[model samples]
Each structure stands twice: as C-alpha cells, then as structure tokens.
Target: MTSLLEGLEFEHCDAAAARSIRDTVEDIYRRSYVQAIASGDPFDSPSEFMRRFDSYTDPRNRGFAYVIARVDGKPAGQIWGWSLPENARWWTGLNLDIGDDLEEFTAEDGTRTFGLSEIMVCTEYAGRGVARALHDELLGSRTELRATLLVEADNERAYQRYRAWGWHRIGWLRPGWPDAPKFDVLIRDLDLAVNEK
Candidate 1:
C-alpha cells in the first residue's frame, strides 16, 4: 500500500545497508530526541545510541530489517526490527511471573515474533504522518504472529500512538542496562482483525 503521507517513500534495507547509513539514522535520532538529550538521558548519548544500533544489526545477526522514509527524496524517518531468537533476552527484565509452562509458551520456533527496536522521525517531519507510514509499512510486512516493542513508560504521546495503532500493553520491564529506564512492553497480534484491515 502507498504511504498516506504525501511525497513520502519507504525503502527497505538489510542490516548491512542500515549500518552503511548509520549517520543518517543517527541524525534523525538526534533531531527527534533532542528533548531527551537535553534532559541528560543516557540512552540519548551518541556512543550509546550507536552501540544499540550496532547490537541490533550485528554481523552475526540472522534476521533483521530496516526501512527509511524519505520526504521529497530527503530522509525524514526510519524504523527497524529483528525476529526474536531462541536465546533472546528481551523478556529477561520483565518484572512479571510466568507459570511452569513459561518456556513452552515463549519458545521461539524461529518466526514466532518480531521485536521492533527503533522508530524515529525527524523533528521537521513531526505530525506529518511520516512515523505512521514507516511504522505501518514495517509491521504490516512482518510474517510473525505478533510483534513487540518497548517504549518509555512515561511517554504519553508514544503510548497514545501505539494504543491507537492497535498495540496492547503486556507489562512493564526495566532493562538490565545501567542507562536503561523502565519501559512498557507492548504487543500487537498480527492475526487479529484490527490489523487485518
């Protein structure tokens, strides 16, 4: 489907291609997250941000995807994610209890779920549907039964957007990383009628 935002274009790139355009992605990140950076947020640190991207697109990675959105042929936003592996520790920090069948329920049979890691829209493009375009295109193309993403617990705007996008909050998680803050873990079931339309 065509992006709703006029003059917007979405292009898919693999992990290597994403790494090649790291600077462009970082530029969008810096602009979209200027407020967080000014607030002394460690996750906004340039080095830390780059490290997070590197971890997502590591050389040994087996599954990953990236989409860069352009407005009038200029980069305006980006989104990317990867399939969760059997060894994935993304849920390790979840402060919730699971019954004895936790392992059986959470086992990754290779394409069970996708983990959406990042989405950023340039400040200049805010409120122009760039983010919704990028986000929908990325998630809609995924084959997994469901998708997951973590957003700051207090980000009301983000929470509203996700909720409006048909995502449901599963629980809260505090990443083990020293600089990471408590985040809400949201899940979007791909098999639902809400996403099918």
Candidate 2:
C-alpha cells in the first residue's frame, strides 16, 4: 500500500480544477456532515456550495495556496490557504487563547502566521491519516506560528481528532453561509522549533 502511494504526486490547483474540487467537496460534505449540524442539505442543493467554492478558489485572491492530494495516482484530498486581511479583515490572524495573553498570528510578521483554512480527506483515506498528513505538510511548509479552523461542535469525532493534535476551542457564532453554528473557534499554535525538520 505504501509503495502504491510512493509514486503519487501532488500539485497546486488551478481555476480549471474547480469542477473537480466541487465534486470532491460535495462527496466529502455528504458523507462527513450530519443533518443535525448542517443547516439542511446543501449538497442536495449544490448552488450555494459552488458559488462559495468558486469565489474562495479564485486566483485573484493574492497569496492563495492550495494543494491537491493524490494516492496511488488518484486525487484523494486537498489543503489550501490564503492571506488574511489586516486586523483579521480577511481573518488572517490566529485566535489562540494561550491561557493568559491574546496575540495575533500573521504571515508577514515574524510573530507567526496563522491559517484559517480547510483540509478534507475522503472516507477511503480516513484511516490512512491523509488529512493530518496534508495538514502538516502545508502548516509546516511555510512556518506559520499558529492556525485556526471552524467546525461543528456536535461532530464530536472531528473535535476529538483536532484535540489530539493540540487544538482548543475558543468560542461560537453563525459563520460564513448556510447559517450554521459551527464550533465558533479552535486554535493551534505552530511550535516552529518543534515542527521544523
């Protein structure tokens, strides 16, 4: 199995791959999201998802970076990020509650950049740890000081997995679209010294 994946390759995605991403995202969202947490069935009505995906992946968004994950020559997952506007106008800041102080993590500042991003692995790749692998690859690549993600609190399984990776919840709200209450905030500080290879 390892050998089958040994030859796999990954590359940066382009505008042309938007359709593939849409399809993959739909598949992952379907199998991963539970009705209890999801606003309804957005996958069934793919319009909004497509619109959001297009805008998010638009190349005009400067400093954007997204990578495709391949396994045994098959596209399996993806990891991507972009610059955040100042003061988190684009949410380019890391919201880490280090128990005592509140600090912002940015890409330009030596202080440490934070990625408010996403990583999705198909169920077939679940046990293989592809999601975590993809995450570590991107997070480690640029030496970000911290990272944050929004997830559904009810999805205990995902929450536990994130916790194991040293992530902690910050708070809650109606994020983005579909009008849902995903776990308001979760953060992880990038220990540059420890993560550096």
Best candidate (score: TM-score): 1
Clashes by residue pair, model 2: 84-92, 88-91, 106-113, 172-184
* Per-model TM values vs. the true structure: 0.90, 0.70
Task: Write candidate 2's Cα lDDT for 48-80 as tens digits.
Answer: 655666777776655456776777666677777
Instruction: Give one digit per residue, the lDDT tens place, for model 1 in 40-130.
Output: 8777787788888888899776778999998788888899998888867887756544343546545775599888999898888888778
Q: Which stretches of candidate 2 lie over 4 Å from their true place?
A: 1-8, 14-40, 43-45, 89-112, 192-197
Which TM-score value belongs to model 2?
A: 0.70
Cα miss at 24, model 2 (Å)? 5.9
Distance from true location, Cα of 133 in model 1, Å: 0.7
After superposing candidate 1, which stretches have Cα over 4 Å from the reference?
1-4, 97-101, 192-197
What lDDT score is found at residue 179 in candidate 2? 43
Residue 176, model 1: Cα distance from true site in angstroms: 2.6
